[model samples]
Target: MILPPHETQAERDASAARFGAELARLTAAAGLPLPPARRLTWCTAEFEGPPATPAPHHGAEPGPPAPDRARLRGESDRYPPHLTLYRGRLPLAEGRPPDLLPALRAVSAWLAGADLAAIRRTAPFLHVQEWAFTHERTPLDRIELNWRVRMQGLAHGPYPVAREDVKALWEAAFAQPRLRRLRPVTSHYTLWFSSTPDYPFERVGASVEPLHRGGYLVRAGGGEPATVATAAEAVALAVAALPPEPV
Candidate 1:
């Protein structure tokens, strides 16, 4: 078996600092000034550069030198220079570097032209949207829901929810005897029930999402979602929809 490289916390931090430094250098070199501090408070600009060095790895006691170990680590991870565009702390776009100078120029132009209202309106949808730019022209002003192509469910835009409502929904779901066996996972404004208790939660059994216009949409076993006006009605519908056997 191949042993993973042993990396200390300090070493990891140093590596991160190096990456950040390189990204900053590239941003300047490309003439893409960072957004103002106030703008950055709500959004961020980030770059993902090609690896500067080969990754470290362990080998047999009398094995090859460090250089050789890096070679064995494989070349697939060494991608081309790219930007990791962000909204707040979350990355909105990554992977597959576009033309470096062209992309940076597009980003610069976008930053200069974009307004606070536009950013504010787009920020919440960043998780389910994608943005791209090229030297040919700056990207479109609007961010679209491109997530459906990759992910299923939610035939329309994202389901919006308030923190207070989410807490109330979680408590209400827990109080339901039928849903007690299923684990509750709240993500992307949707509350999912899964048989597995851990992160992967492979066995999803039901879901509840708040409708944009008002009301909650509850679904079970891949069936159609049913909307109800009140949280009590939503919870009751969810409990009734669940499988009779314990999940």
Candidate 2:
């Protein structure tokens, strides 16, 4: 996986330290206490398409491989997983939070009842080339929704207050300057995945797939979903039927 822009490891570390200090101060000012941080799990609901045919590039040539479902699954895992342009942390309140778990269950219910067929039909494939500079450009036709469900679950098991407080905390947190700068798209889901230390982005191989034929593929070593969307309408459609929260 491509690292964020920093000249060296030392530079990256220094920057992180500085940011962490600033974040601590901000959290203090927000009247919010930091709960035990947990790794976030996430997946992308991408547009359906054919897997990109492997081709030779940069002084290399393509090699033929057998076309078996098991092999294809393995091959698909070798390519770069779809990128998540945005991420947010959801921490549970101390002394046990309320409505958090229920909120997650509510979201789960909505997702369980989600119409995958509509998402497939409405959303179109976004070529990798289109995402070359996603870090700089605001995504078009995509809204990335993030929630801190795992931390909430750990803090309070299946409690209704956990969900409510979490929603409030997130709403308040989103209004902060740091989060506003991140510019997340609306209408996405939060699923559990391995933490950053074991994040799967690094395992993505260098292959592009066709958009319409293969559907989304899993990256090798990274169990995260591979999906991409380029249109806001499609994102809205995906989340439109989800449970609504008062902002």
TM-score of every model?
A: 0.33, 0.19
Q: Which candidate is the best by lDDT?
A: 1
**Which residue pairs in candidate 1 have backbone atoms (N, alpha carbon, C) closer than 3 angstroms, thus clashing?**
none
- Model 1: residues with Cα > 4 Å off, grouped in runs: 1-162, 202-204
What is candidate 1's lDDT per residue for 157-227, written digit by digit as tens? 12222355555666677667656656566667787766654457764456788776877888877677788
lDDT of 1 at 183: 59
Q: Give the lowest summed-lDDT range of ten residues in model 1.
A: 66-75
Poorest lDDT segment (10 consecutive residues) of candidate 2:
66-75
lDDT of 2 at 46: 14
Number of backbone-clashing residue pairs for each candidate, in the order shown: 0, 35
Q: Cα RMSD (Å) per model?
A: 18.6, 24.1
